[model samples]
Target: MTVKPADLLWPASTARLAIRPAVVEDLPRIFEYYRKPEVSEWLASHPADLDAFIERARQPELLACIYVVERGDIHIGDLYMGIRDAWAQKEVQAQAHATQAEIGYVIAPDYAGQGYANEAVAELLRICFEDLGLRRVTAECLAENVASWRVMEKAGMRRETVTRQASLHRSGRWLDGYGYAVLADEWRGSLVS
Candidate 1:
């Protein structure tokens, strides 16, 4: 199971959305969601301003992937995933990729409730399992965000766990969180189903 970063494709798209690598031009649109109090409240940190976002959006050397989600040329959202060591037993880790990645996404509030997140996440699962050949992909969100967890489920990821007071919200308080994930085999089986 060897995979070099060059083997993956960029700017992948679906019927209604385009999933592409982040570009400098995406700052303004990406900032649109990052700056909103409603949007930033759930995230770990909020961008102080445009310059902060610019600094944060810079692609790093070893990224699983960071994709901007667009609709008809509009930068409506972004998706991100990064590989991390698994916490399972030695035998389980040896049998799996030894590493799994977590995924997350953000959509502009104006575009919320339109099923765009669901489509983008489903496509992301394809890229993670099929293109990147990753063994597993996971995601988590503040438990209060029903929509976010629902998107993960709609994308075929099963709820793996939940932790109370595991996350610190922008509101300066601990919040419950939900973890969801899908294995490569499970995703493939879902496609057939």
Candidate 2:
């Protein structure tokens, strides 16, 4: 039920970017990005230390596929996506039935607003719906994070719902969350229409 890197293609690239697996050697760069207050503000938690970051990067592949988003050789951000129901993998494979996956992304503060997140997400969605053969891909972000939701919209996802106080922020206050999703057929339709 666990999805492994070997189960999918590696080093998929866009014209201006290269998406690759997150490796142990990437720990320091990962830590640097997550440690920044601006970068970690919307995330669930900031790494306590480099060791914690290293541990996080080492999570089981079945839980999520963590990818490094790079421009040439520079580490700019990350793309995190994981299947929602492990037991449904076989049904999905055999039936071409609907299955769900979740995606999340972050970019360096300096690189904000350059359309990179949108560009990266579009490719990730192709891999999700095409390469991974998923039925739907979803993303949730705090309602206040305009850039986050905007990226989802720019990547062809629609805002499905907003849940009140869906998450407890690092500041101790609950925040509303916006859910966005796009179906595989919808995504494919966008390509031609």
Candidate 1 residue-wise lDDT, 16-131, digit = tens: 99988776777777777888987887777787878767776764632335678989978889888776667767778765553577889999898988999999999988887877
lDDT per residue as tens, model 2, 78-131: 988877653446646644433677899989887777888988999999888777
Clash count of each predicted structure: 0, 0
Could you tell me every candidate's TM-score relative to the true structure?
Answer: 0.87, 0.87
Candidate 2: TM-score?
0.87
> In candidate 1, which residue ranges exceed 4 Å CA deviation?
4-6, 59-64, 88-98
